[model samples]
Target: MPVTSIVKDPEALSLTVHAEFPVKVARLWDAYLDARQLEKFWGPAEYPATFTRHDAAAGGRSNYHMTSPEGEEFHGYWEWNEVVEHKFFEVTDGFAHPDGTPNTDLPVNRMVFSFDPTPEGTKLTITAAFDSAEDMEQVVAMGMIDGTRSAMSQIEQVLIDLRNYSQTFATEAELVSDTQVRVVRLVRGTRQQVWDAHHDAALVKRWQYGPDGWSMTKCDLASGIGESYLLWWAPEDGGQGFGFSGKILERVEGHYESSTEQLEGGEEILGSGVPGSVNQQTFTGTTGGTLVTTLITYRDKAARDAMLATGMADGMEASYARLESIL
Candidate 1:
């Protein structure tokens, strides 16, 4: 791994460190914003860190603690002052008590992190400004520079692990029977959140589109059993698009929902003889997060085969991948 460049300016009472990452700016930005990703590289190896609270936005606060090899814990907090997506953020960083209360006895600093895209990858510059030169000296003596470098060295591996995990967790689809197709994904959210993504019209409009250049133009939902729901889609270039409306068959709030879907348009590709399908979705809480299982049962084998031949599974996978971003 490459070493970080650390510069100390006594006259300005500031310390700056420059680190380069062999990854895109979005990946680097996500590593800092996502709590699960942040925990992997926020501290040195011997002193692993865990975040109890993480909200990556202006006016938000993150409280975390590092557990040493000797079993001792050091708590800290960051008050985000400014945040610009994929660019930079400023935070008030300081020590805190175990209960997350500020520790006045410890040194506090204002830190700014700027991210710049490069031909190689992303370059991140972090500058910490102290109240006085004495404060800067005290923190340097306390191993701030060394600890930061060690922590930053772990990010490359973290990004690699994240990439691998995403590939492993991609949505999976299988033909359960001649008339039934099953699609499953392990989403990183609670059962309720996953359910809401399906039931809420606004959220559904955001991720239900299968691929790029397509948008959901309309979404109207009636949550009650026996109610009907309608959705519409259109291409960016004003090309003709297809959509479907469904009648709710079953509803078990936040757990299960079943509907009968009747497709509109694209009849030639979907086979005009193809019948509607009953789509049943189940949300189950799992150790990892929420397991979402969607089963589509056609009226007959011919209908199911026609739908599958139209690349429905590939479209579903793309849509589900988009849902992961919002969650």
Candidate 2:
């Protein structure tokens, strides 16, 4: 479909605005696929929105509500079907009363999102088709264009900030510097699934380690200090052992504490003679699933330098991609 205006009938009393978001395909896919993220910055001017009863499958039902600052509430729902991640989704949207009564005048839109990667970024084109000209015009005049533009602007900045943080956080010298690393990913799955992936050593071995034939050898799940694990990365190419040996320096169980250890260095590797600081992993439950956080500290300059020199950013990104795949 062509990227056209949402103003269905400008000569009539109503018009709707359409927007195109030039964003990274992965980020855009996350924005749509992750419901928790939908609740964050989904609307313009902080218009709070909640996604309720979302199944995100064919013949399933989902609803959304936008509450204005002045105590006004707008409710809508969709008979969700034909979902293809980062490709397309069709929904029946309308004026559902706060009490769940549907209004027929509002249109049910077939929304399509296509991602085309280019040198600049992914061209995200979102198109919605309304039933009639009047319905299209009504939604258009409600600031759909400006609202979408603002929300997408926020999304673009968010991606940029995340990429910047990934580089700066890894290469920085100070352990607890002026800014700490923060994870804002929206993990989609059941709580049990997320928790299992997190605490299970086998799953961690698959996701946390690099793809060059790496695996976890040991883990201690004690609730106190001094618990530790050794992740052994023995490549099949007859490469030497290269891995991180971590020990719990402090304990907070479910919340977060500190894991201090050292990255072993071989002839091709460089281990930090100084303590490699601590890694604080925090897990929190959300409506859809769990949010996992990892904050690593490299207090020593040499440690940070070695990791960065080995393409830390790419490695970290690959690790995250693996994690997503596992979950």
Candidate 3:
């Protein structure tokens, strides 16, 4: 578990809580914006919190309540003051009534959440300022520190759940025929962005490798019909290298692209005379993002089964996971 530190500054009438997560900054930062994700770790272990309203933008307001073991409810609300994407945000937080009204008698604290990218991952620092030292001391004495620590302890698991959910969300592969396989995923970008990521050599090099300890050594992409392209990958340990080269068969700018991809120099691994596949990639705009569908047509059933045996679906999933980071 990552260490979570809580510090109090009486002179400044502030309390700061710090925690580090072994996840990308964007993922960690997104947790706050997502209402469902926030409910997973917004309170202590025993007292689960529920969000009634979550609007994550500057001037937005959020209302939530935590239920105690005895079924008592503690409501809270946040008035967002500033929001900077993937970096930090400021909000005024305080106790509220069950009907989403603030409790004027309770202490209102200003909280600033700072997300810093570290070598290991992301470090999140939460600085909360009260109107006076007495107010800060009053909250601290009410087990605020312990409650925060307990809540922060759940973040690691939340991140894991988010990752697992992301890897499986809207991702599927099915064999449509003996000679064809369709793979689909909801990519987090527009059609043009997804198209550029696939066609641009620089972006392709960042996510072409499907697994760890392998890197794309060379990638040459020509974006027109009848153009030629080559992509090569080498193991980090300088092991055997493999690649694919082919000519584009069809292209529709940001909508679709098709090419005949032939594996090069993998006879030992894939067996002799393994035929190539016609790979077609299609991108469509969706309400949430872009829907990317890949169709691979093999020469015959033998070629399709051979490709499946290579765990091609798993490789595609892994590669898409990498692509999600860049997008």
Candidate 4:
């Protein structure tokens, strides 16, 4: 994790974030100035950002939007007030409408990003000043802290050498918020290959099952938006079986997909102490292969915690590792 601490000062009407990355100051600075790298970590895992235009020079404006798994878009803009290459930059960040018009109804913030070389690597500090304590508290209540932390924690992956982040890397899960968790891994396959492996019944049957002694007994797949799938697994030794059923909510071929998932029996399963969740999966083609990120949004904090406690990520990791081997 790159972010060290996030401090709030009511008297100063500001929120400051401190983070250090093991990289040169120039490299850290470029990650911010370049839209390509910026977008990768600008928003949280589930809501990915896209910068339509970026100009960090003085008097320039950068426009971007983050799209939620449900297709909602949140727009924002940064009006560059000052720029000092490899040192610091100042901008007035504000909320905007989908059409790019400024949304004055929402509170705006003035942000300053400072970069300095450190003994370990580079230190980056960001201070966002607000007009009043009311505005500052409002943003905090809107989950800004967790969102920023989730976004900043992803910087390390973007900063690492591509060779070090290849298919050999193990799967990892990061808690983004009380109700969300992000799992990521590098697969030894192209984005299309990964997508196909997930959709093809034959490939899915080969790897989607759990650990040793378990076999997938049924695989009813759904390949398009608004479709549904049912997958069941049982122990080869005749132990009890369980299954998952989900409905595809969104999809962008070879890139991203989102679906609502739950235990097979719906109300019957819910009554037995299981809650539903939404999963968003995104695949990015990397130099080595494909990077797969799955963001799971649980019904509540308790639900999220329970799901994680069930060793779901561990099972997924084993399944993904098996997929890579077959690929």
Best lDDT among the predictions, by candidate number: 4
For every model in order, what is the number of clashing pairs? 0, 5, 0, 0
Instruction: At residue 308, give the lDDT of candidate 1.
Output: 78
Query: Stretches of candidate 3 above 4 Å error?
Result: 166-327
How would you order the candidates by lDDT, starting with the best?
A: 4, 3, 1, 2
Question: What residue pairs are clashing in model 1?
Answer: none
Cα lDDT, model 3, residue 218: 87
lDDT of predicted model 3: 0.80
RMSD of each: 14.7, 13.9, 16.0, 11.4
Order of models, best TM-score first: 4, 1, 3, 2
Worst 10 residues of 2 by lDDT: 166-175
lDDT, candidate 1, 1-327, per-residue tens: 645689999888999989988887877876776555677889787898876555455666777899998989999999879887688999999999988899999899999999999998999999999998878888899999889888988888898878643324567767755777877677878767988998888899888965688788889887799999888887888887777888998666676677999888856545676578998776655445666767788988998887777777678777877888899
* lDDT (10s digit) by residue, model 4, range 1-327: 888999999999999999998888877775676555688889788889876545556766677899899989899999889988688999999999977789999999999999999999999999999999999998899888999999998888888842233434578877766777877777888768998999999999999887788889999999788889999888899877788999998776666678998887433322455668998776655555666767788989988887777777788889988998999
Between candidates 1 and 3, the lDDT winner:
3
Tens-digit lDDT string for candidate 3 (106-189): 899999999999998999999999999878988888889889999999999999877754333456777755787777787888
Which residue pairs come into collision in candidate 4?
Answer: none
